[model samples]
Target: MDNAATTKITENVLKAMLPYLRENYGNASAIYSLGQKSRAAIENSRIKIAENLKVKPSEIYFTSSGSESDNWVIKETLNPREKNHIISSKIEHPAILNSLKSVERFGNETSLISVDEEGFVNLDELSEKIKDNTKLISIMFANNEIGTIEPISEISKIAREKNILFHTDAVQAMGNVKFNLKDIDVDMLSISGHKLGAPKGIGILYIKEGVEISPFINGGEQERGMRASTENIASIVGIAKAIEDAYANMDENINYTSDLRDYTIEKLLNIDGIIFNGPIDNRLPGNINITLKDTKPQTMVQYLDMYDICVSSGSACAAGSINPSHVLRAIGRSEEDSLSTLRLSINHNNTKEECDYVVEKISEGMKKFKNR
Candidate 1:
């Protein structure tokens, strides 16, 4: 149910990476035969990802994590030397929000556009927020906590009309949703491998052609000098294989997981004081967010963990924080409801039986907590 945090690496992806981790252990920068082989593998992975996104191979740049990708794109696009302003929504993942804060620290202005109660970014507010100095409009393809998919194409069109650079933190939507970069006119997008059943430490930033931004890391002339570092060949191979598998089985997996998610939602709704957050029709197929009016999510999460059933109160990155979810607040959930919210994000691996068991546990926890 915590697939949003990260996913277990698929066996096939691990198999594809084993050889590189052992026998082909060579730095991609070396001109030797073994190193050249590693370099070729890295380029191949980049091409594979680019093809899946319907973008040119040269546009793909790998990073250590989705957070790094988001940070780099924002930092590069918004130069602090100038009075550049950025526009983003209030419900974005912490990675994007924190990156914006970093720019804000350097005196770059930012406008966090409001969202509707359903968690969709207010396009009117966004359009109004853009100024002559607005350099970029960064929004997430989907909300991590509430499972709301944004109107990305519409947002892109607005950005294009206003001549502002657009970037989407698509870390949560890359594998779970089907999209083509050629069909959308965004300047840049970010994706994470771990969300798609690849290991952590491998992420991608897609920069459209002719969109010039400064280099992220400054060192050896790697990644065509845009990002300079020794590439992780094994993880790169794993991410490529994982993304390939994801697209290959996208329709089938989405249908199956959506059925499970709906079934779980139906059963959970039978409980008292159940409030479903986010739009039912415009949400990710695998995500279900709900709040029990009288219950705290952490209390239910602790009880669920006791049964060895994993779940999350909100973003796993904010696991220890007692603060109300920023996403719920954006959607107009009261502080009480925000504290009571639970995010159940499914994946293809989950089954109807497993969802039923989870619902049962939640019902039991509600009873136990109510009694207390």
Candidate 2:
């Protein structure tokens, strides 16, 4: 299942975007009727996204992607305050962790909390890391590689208790899990549309009310000057429609996908020398990360590709790299285990027949590798 990286857009979302691309094209800022119509469509999208997130429309800032949103929030939150310390986990996506690297150049102090064997942040260590100078705490809602779901609400509580702002990169969790911004009490969150069967280049950053931060892209006063560009009207509408549909069907999707995931995992484990990674229970519904003890992940990925069974070695963004997964390393995996890891992320559209095909391909590949 390669769906964790991106999903095929739903028919309804595609239809929702067509008019804007064809007949309704207009600069949202113009005073003309077409412009007003475009502007209204953008506002409607904002309202729907805000309603789903349980936040005010004003708090939702449309962004280009999850990376841009993560970069914007981290840079803005840490730059304004004299306090330069930040708290994050070792297993955060490069969007957050790499952004933190740039923040450090501005003389900011950073505390990276270590994760346990399951890729979960140690809450006790997280509490110890926060200090008076710690202005922001950034963590991921779920890992892209292993699908380890973090304790965001618990971490948010800690950040609230210490009066520090908290942000979560919820790109992987948004459509797959039940989330309410109010319930988490987080100050900011980031999610990308492609993760939920919408188009790429569209995402949302939820900023808590009254949290003043600088804009990432400087231009005309769009997104209240927090982000500035002519609205991506069609994609924004598509995102809103996709999120609504995903949330509405979340329960059924979870049940179906989870069954597929379990079936695949059970079949894989029946083979010799296979080990699963991440928390068995506290993980995403359709994620199954496993390692064949002696085979390299890249080799297995290539073998599977030949059989038309797509999978990933780590994060899709990092798939081209020769380096082992940082998330696996953080969870105390050996180099051998890390090199062998393969991630299979399913979705509602995946079928049992597809699962059987993948298992057959994997078993065949492993047998060949063992012989060699």
Q: Number of the top candidate by lDDT?
A: 1
Q: Model 2 over residues 1-372: C-alpha lDDT tens digits?
A: 799989989999999999999899988999999999899999999999899888999999999999999999889886554748989999999999889999888888888999999998999999998887888999999998888899999999998899898999999999888888988888999999999989999999999998867889999999888789999999999999999898889899988988889899999998887899998887898999998888877888888898788898888899788888888989999876887788999999999999998988888888888534
Q: Give me the runs in candidate 2 sitting further than 4 Å from their true place.
A: 80-83
RMSD of 1: 1.0
- What is the alpha-carbon lDDT for the whole of candidate 1? 0.90
How do all models score by TM-score? 0.98, 0.98
Candidate 1 lDDT over residue span 1-372, tens digit each: 799989999999999999999999899999999999999999999899888888899999999989999998888987657989999999988888998898888889999999999999999999999999999999999888888899999999999999989999998898788888998778999989999999999998989999979999999988999999999999999999998999999999988888888889999999887888998877888899998778777888999999988899988988989899999998898887898888899999998888989999999999888624
Count: clashes, candidate 2: 0
lDDT of 2: 0.90
